[model samples]
Target: MLLVLVVLGLAAAAWARTASRGWGLAALGVVVVLAAIVLTVRPRPATRLPETGELEVGGRRVTGLVLPLRRPSGAQALGVAVLAVLFLGAAVVTFVTQRPAPPDAVFGMVLLAVFGVLFAVAALALWAASGRVPYVGLTPTHLLVFQETAQVEVPWSDLAGVAPVVARTGASPLPDAVGSWVAVRVRTGSPAASGVKLRGPASRVVTQVPGPTGTTTAALIGDVHWAVDPVLAWWTLSYYAEHPAERRELSGPAAVERVTAGDLR
Candidate 1:
């Protein structure tokens, strides 16, 4: 109601000055509202390593590498919950107090109430998971990914290779806005790779890596995306795969410093 009043006042004030000015104000207002609706959360990393750089999670560990995770924002959910409650209350009040209410008023009220309940549930869940955001670690022996409740540790010996893949997400209207992924290519017919799919939840894309002319038989298992920087994740993983001697540093602060600096050694 307050936002509506503010916009209405701005439009009215602008119109008194000039019709063109009023229309421009209304257009700007529409664009602001649309941008807010389009973006789900602030574009930031979902996880961050502390200054010390050495940390342990999920009884597993990793060094240097960082995989992407879906950034979660509880504030966004809570804001929606508050609005849902307000709008729902207004709808109920209007339906009950209005004389000669429309025939569909009750049905509309019911639908709105159901939506309100969903918003409330989302708000509660987000708040509950506030401080426990999952993190990924780099270790010499394995590629460790920690989730909210469980973790996945893929031994370096069991993996064939890792590469950075940029797939056409079509997630945005902008042409250049592509999504990044770290594809852990599993060795074909390797018995150890059989359980790779159980590493995490399910991946949205499972296509093979593109080579010179066609795709390879190496399986792309369940992988995460949207890490703070996918290219860095790929570089760290690949570097360690090629240089087995440096794997031990993954559990130390020096590795974190190097990864953060984008240093090539």
Candidate 2:
């Protein structure tokens, strides 16, 4: 996907050098293509268990799903599709209604330059969309997230607590077009340290964590929030926490000898 965008962006740049105005359309096309790519890339399924032979967390099972947060709903996708069709129709009508003479060399060059700029902008938009959160994982001990800049792993043990932070839909500076997200507050070890905030549909899982040591409790926010069943996640964790016998930790040579002799228990 990234490769295709790069190729399109390069092509747009070349076209912009000759006809600047064409850049706009090329750029728009790039953004649309990139968005489509992100929406189409399927997320991997959640890990159900640790790799074989590895020591499992004592009395703690880890499990959860990581899904794309900004996926467009059926209605939203249809609406956008309709709008695109209408816009395309308008562009076709305009092209058919007016016939202009060929541009002189200088005019053509200027148009090409404009087109290049537009294409560059579109390519950038595509790049930005690519950075959107791809998925999130809730485990017994941590919250794993793939953000545009980096993979964030928030260990439950490190978290002093969790809370719900609200950002209204259409809120300034947020990436999404509609609906705010439940923000998570990670307590800082020091007073000077800053808390991290995870937002958007990606933040849905954070809201499921038991809390009140964290943030303001809005009225039945859970009803409106996008979240997995907290109880289920909690229950799974609790099972691991209680089943210490299932957990294993490796010991020294005696342990290896016992296993080789088929005396491992």
Candidate 3:
């Protein structure tokens, strides 16, 4: 997560540099600060091998890394904390400076309450993010993608295919902020009769792979959407789907690089 943020910060700085001198310098400062803090306590990657070893599923040992929705970064927590403090300070000031029975006192009180609530919510979010957040697990027989409040799991048998998804605006030539992502196509229910019809947000699904029975359901995997190395993630999912027997090779970094180049182009 820290790595991802650092990259994003650098990218932002690069863009800002082209716009103006002061904005670029300020952006560069932010990038440097984030990079310095990240070097000391860098968050782990979203994808990782299970800590408790291989999982048992349907009498078979499933081996593979679990790619969670995303990892939290210290910089985000710090930013949240600062905002919470500012909100709380503003609320206190509003309450303390209010005149009793004044025409705008009621409005001031309400504003103070709102700030207090915002402060509390931000603090709680910081706490949750600081702790261990739930994550998606990727196994030999299954792929779990965690959302805000839910998780979807697709068994290897049901997983039809995986591919890269490039985001695009409707009839717009502008590039999206998030360059690319990976989506996992899963087969749901029995085969459809006549022509296959899979329904969902068509815009989100970049491309479709023929399901096990020609008809299939497709949904985006939010977990790998913001991965540090989306290309590697796509390669991993595609590799496992194509070669399920090569589960052991999914553990090492060198092995992963051998399959899907060491860096993003």
Candidate 4:
């Protein structure tokens, strides 16, 4: 399909150059229609993944898993890299070649200075994200969210229930910030239960649905839309949450097999 589109685009250009502009415009229109149809008709690509047969990520191995993880799609990283390169490149090019009126020169210099800092910050953030790994744990006794510093966790006994939250919840403006996120609804009224946690840094993209407005609480896991198969992860989490007996296999290879075999459905 891509090849066909490329050929059509080339043909349109050639026709415009060698023949008539009207014919080229018509050909280009046909190519556009075909491209739209192809894009719409095809299934969306799933996120790319590293091999999880061993449940290893970033050279770190896991003893168990509720569900295996997926390598985040590099599209976001690539995009950031591209933007950084373009901004930095533009600044250099402007410095070397662009000559403006006297007053505008200072304005241009400031813009160029800002561009350098932006590129540096973007590259640093990208590097940090690429090397990070997030792991969630549900032991026989507790539900743990592994973090780099001093923190607390919810006990399994404290869990009222777990459900997959796929949509933008409530009137919170936070969800509109990122593309896709999985808000895992972890319901509990215990005091140990942590409150709202947003998708600010490398932590779980979470939003707290405290008991004040409602009888239950929630923890939203965002940014995984680019990480894992959101639907599959949703189902698998729900399956383990709802089926207590099934969780016995969660700490072993059988859990991996269950997830792989579509047993969650």
Per-residue lDDT value at 175 in model 2:
65
Stretches of model 2 off by over 4 angstroms after superposition? 1-70, 73-79, 99-136, 146-151, 171-181, 187-265
Q: What is the lDDT of residue 231 in candidate 1?
A: 53
Q: Residue-wise lDDT of candidate 2 within 126-226, one digit each (tens)?
A: 45654454444444354444444444455554444333334334324546443323333344452212334445544454454424454322111221322
Winner by lDDT between candidate 2 and candidate 1: 1
**lDDT of all predictions:** 0.51, 0.39, 0.49, 0.47
Off by over 4 Å in 1: 1-71, 98-103, 168-177, 185-202, 207-228
The alpha-carbon lDDT assigned to residue 162 of candidate 1 equals: 69
Candidate 3 lDDT over 108-176, as tens digits, reads 445534644664576566557656544444664566555444345567677767766555423335543
lDDT of 4 by residue, 1-265 (tens): 4543464354343334332354645465455445434433434456642123323322445445533233323444444454444334434544544454255544554564475467558656655654655445544444444332222355555566555433444345445433344343344456545563444432322333332333243344444423456566666666777777777675566776777676885
Q: Per-residue lDDT tens digits of candidate 1, residues 81-109?
A: 56355435434554554446555555555
* Candidate 3 error regions (>4 Å): 1-62, 67-70, 101-109, 133-137, 146-151, 168-178, 190-228, 244-265
Model 4 steric clash pairs: 196-208, 197-206
For model 1, what is the C-alpha lDDT against the true structure?
0.51
Clashes of each: 7, 22, 1, 2
Best TM-score goes to which candidate?
1
Comparison by lDDT, 1 against 4, better one: 1
